[model samples]
Target: MNDSADYCDDFYNYVCGGFVNSTLIPDDKNSVNIFITLNDKVTKQLNTIISRPSQPDEPEIFKLAKSLYKICMDTNAIEEQGVKPLFDYVEQLGGWPVLKKDNEWDESLFNWKENIAQILENKFWVTGFFGFYQTIDIKNNTRRVIGLSDYNAGLARKNLIKGLEDKSVLNYFNYMVNMSVALGAEQEHAEEELKEALEFEIKLTNLTRPDEDYRDQTLAYNPMTLGDLAKRYPYFEWKKYFNYELSPSNISVDNDEIIIVSNPDYFDKLDELIDSTPKKTQANLLIWKEIRSLSGFLNKNIREVNGNYAKIRTGIIKGTPRWMKCTNTVSSTFSIATNALYVREYFKKESKDNVAVMIKNIHNQFIKLLNSTSWLDEETRINAIKKAEKINQFVAYPDELLNNSIINDYHKAFENFEMIGDSYLESSSNLDFFGNKIGWSELREKNVPNMWDSFATRSSTANAFYSSSENSIMLPAGILQGEFFNNELPKYMNYGAIGGVVGHEIMHAFDDQGKQYDADGNVFDWWSNSTNEQYKKKAQCIIDQYGNYTVKEINMNINGINTQGENIADNGGIKAVYLAYNDWSSNNELEKKLPGFNFNSRQMFWVAYANTWCSKSRLESQKLRLIYDNHSPSEFRVNGPLSNIEEFSTDFGCPIGSKMNPEKKCTIW
Candidate 1:
């Protein structure tokens, strides 16, 4: 504890000051927090599993994952081959115009529209001008449909809007120039052509909307027939593009078929830009995107150039070690296999059972909180309870992970993919095609509701998620270890740490966004108009409360509208879990006090909760997150939630109007 600061004044500092003051952010990372520190342990465990020599008797998925890791780790092969593999890949894409001298390029040969469809079919993963993928139809969550939206830009919309004035945008331009030049383009020519490409990207970004602007799902969800879409935005031939992209999966699209255009205006704006901009500039941007996406996977020189851009983007002084990079890539790309391997080697059944029990207790506490909330009408209150009861809890790894048949079926898309181990670039390209092929293939199959296959893409990570489409909360095996949970820790500490996370995820079902989805996970309104108004009023209090908190380092207040859902979850989570912990303590015998502290069990609980968010971050990362991240900074995450809970003030004996004991506290669950 920091004796200099009082607990009531700054709960986060009092609890986390010692660690934050003493610890340094790792050179390879932009921030160091409890979550990041614990994740390092999980990565080390995965590295041990993936680095083992491949076994002949292992499952095909296991062998494939191991082989992919082996290929990524072979720096000698990558360095020797140099950029030749990438240049060859580019030749197949009808050539990057910037690579050729001005007059030598044949613009007639390169059709950006046809090239886009070809890349989508062959590469399957990289999204250039537009994005097309399967998503759960919001109104009918029982099935998936193709959703089209604007491209995921190289720079974020927020940064791109700043034009060349933004340092990140400037760095991106430099990265583009340097990368094209490395591929044998003349420096001056590459810069001149790529400058137009960069400007085209900025123009495209302006046409698209920011994520914060689309919080109201109705504004974003526009279901249109393929025929209608073709008639409305005729510049790019939507019908032909869809047919070409989906033909590889043997899924045909007719004129009457329905697809969700998430951003309808984007197509209109895009058509205008397509008509005005030169085809050469558009082609350069398209290929530049491909180059940017594959740069990190190329030779050492290309990777160094890529790493330099990352340093500016994330504020890291050094690049991550190669083994760690390869490990993370393998884990994400082969998530199902990684989950199976992680569970078989490390996770215990007892931990799963224990977390399940905690989830049940916290869930019951939330229902009780809803029952007693005076602001909610009786009908709304009852429906809220039913929704809470219906929430599915997926604790630790799914049972399907233990079955080889299911694992193999999940990996059937990669049936044709083989790793030659001679070239990482070729292997990576094939993996991208096969891996992303699964998402496109889903369009052919009706989504089986409440199945683990749809949502278990990432189970071996140190995180928790509440999926609105599934109406479920997933507590992955990765989060069950380290500081988050322990078998031998006191019930209070365990309840305070992981229990808070469990409660937070549960509360999300009633947050601004999640509340829109009903118990069936359909986008239906279950609340009465009167009750809805009351809920909004309560939410506004939270919005205003968090909006006032300024991150002094950045001189910017928190984007309360952007982060309201998370703040609500954080507050409601701690509140429900604390009461649940009290009930458990009352029934069971109170555990003996610890050796170092004189505080009671309740006080220790709050300290443990705060400790989970203990962190130190670089200024650059902090600025970036403040602008984009939905969650508040680590310090605010602790203090912001605690300050609003009267239970915390009473336990700490904080005065009625101290910083931690505000006169007005916002509570909405």
Candidate 2:
């Protein structure tokens, strides 16, 4: 695998190749080519249905067909179900016309509000729903520890204990719980099947590296990771503490230095600028404030429950998982844990330099990619390049922020576990009910930085995102290694796998959602109405097209209406990366093709792009996603976009009118 050709094969076989084969459903010569030849007809029918107003006595068959079509095209069944349920729920709560009867709230509406609140509360518990609450629980020897999970979970448990305090909400919760329980019972069979699939991935990883140690390997880092670690040590969940370290370093402002300021003054400045910020940026900031407030409240609650703060602290430290310790030894929280794990597992130390170099090289390539975009206006392009240049790259760990006294001070402030827990719930509930007044002042404060540093720790994390509010892109340390990046892989493979990801984050600055924010990371609309309209029209075409797809056997409809922004980003990111790759090839005088692959780098680029999104999900999960998630499923993500991209068809030699090559195309950026 060290040689370029071997590296390419390893990459093609292990990473990008799997996606190409898995997602591109081969056309059956004997079967009717419904998708290939009748896309227009199907699309037209879907459009007609979408345009029509609700009518009583509509054909049941039409409803079923439309539902099935939605399930297939959209890759989300849950969302499809949500369409009718949400509409019904809203209407039942009070028809939209009735709710909108008054511009302002009426005292009579209090019943409606109370009903809605009860329903929301009930939904929380059954669905692991949580809301803010204050409670104290005794631990061994009269000590206490604060426990915080999803607010919904707490709320649901409380509702159960209180015997369904609100009848309307209680009934809803009961119905949902019964359905979920029944679903769980039915799903037991499917779980067996899925276990094999999951185990297969694990086995593949194990088989591929038989010589490597497996005892210490961990699943991807997430909030779930904390849960997993807590199973081994019920006394404490160390993932929380580790998160405290990782999140702050993840903050970036327009690719500049990763600044984690807790100064009240900074919060004040941010408040002053909020009105001037773009809507999306403001929305994201508000959301972050909500999340942070929740986090703080959770910490406070745990402290209040535990009488001995030191014991609670010990539990947190001792609960640090072995894998996290190995990954983040430099940090005080994980240093002892890492040493203990190393000794326990007898694992050899790997060079941090290798990981650092990979990150640096990828970061540099992304910068170069940003320099090559032809679509951006010169002024925008120059600023984009400067932003790329300014981006501070922190690979694998925090710099020196760990030593800040704020970390210690935060620990000291939580002198009582029960009070901390109560404070957490109160703070979170207040934030939710009253809006972001705390955020306004907190942003101005320069006392301590917010955000956890676990994002920089080693472990596997599949997710990545660009924070418009922070003006930064975060690649968790866990995702930096593995199939996404390896020094041994060919540049094409790297670009297609991790390189495409880097490009994706970089291009996010210009995505429909991200573009709302300016270079400074403040949200403000800068596009002319004409340009914005043009983009929206193009985006709508994609929505309509995607809305027409169906999942076999399910009566579902994908909501292209909801998923438009993500679709735009997917299409635009692929284009930007491909262009960037071409620029790199031309400037560096690299070989036009990898040995043995017999494809030009340009062709490989699209293939790589397709491969990154290869995934399989349970039908139930798929259904759930349609209702909630913004992105389309993996199969549609590959097939839908590829069919629309002329470049992809040209490379694959997909004849016109083929499933992969449609006569009509939709383009938006």
Give the runs in model 1 whose Cα sits over 4 Å from its true position. Answer: 116-127, 412-416, 454-456
> Residue-wise lDDT of candidate 2 within 390-451, one digit each (tens)?
54443433432233343334333222211111122332232233222222223223322113
TM-score, every prediction? 0.96, 0.45
**Candidate 1's residue-wise lDDT over 1-669, tens digit each?**
677889999999998889878988879999998688778888999999989988887778888889889989989989998887777767766689998877877788666666642322264323377888778899998677888888678877888879789887888899899888888889999889999999999999888888887777777789999899889987777777777667766778999988899888888888678779997898899888888878878888888888888788789999999999999999888888887888888889999999998899999999999988988998888888889899998988778888888888877766666785568877777676665556676686777666876446666779898988778998888899888899999888898899989999998999989999888788888999999998899889989988999988768788889999999999998999999999889999988776798889999899989988988888889888987799999888899999999999999999999999989888886
> What pairs collide in candidate 1?
none
TM-score top scorer: 1
RMSD of each: 2.0, 23.1
Largest lDDT belongs to which candidate? Answer: 1
lDDT (CA) for every model shown?
A: 0.84, 0.40
The TM-score that candidate 1 achieves is 0.96
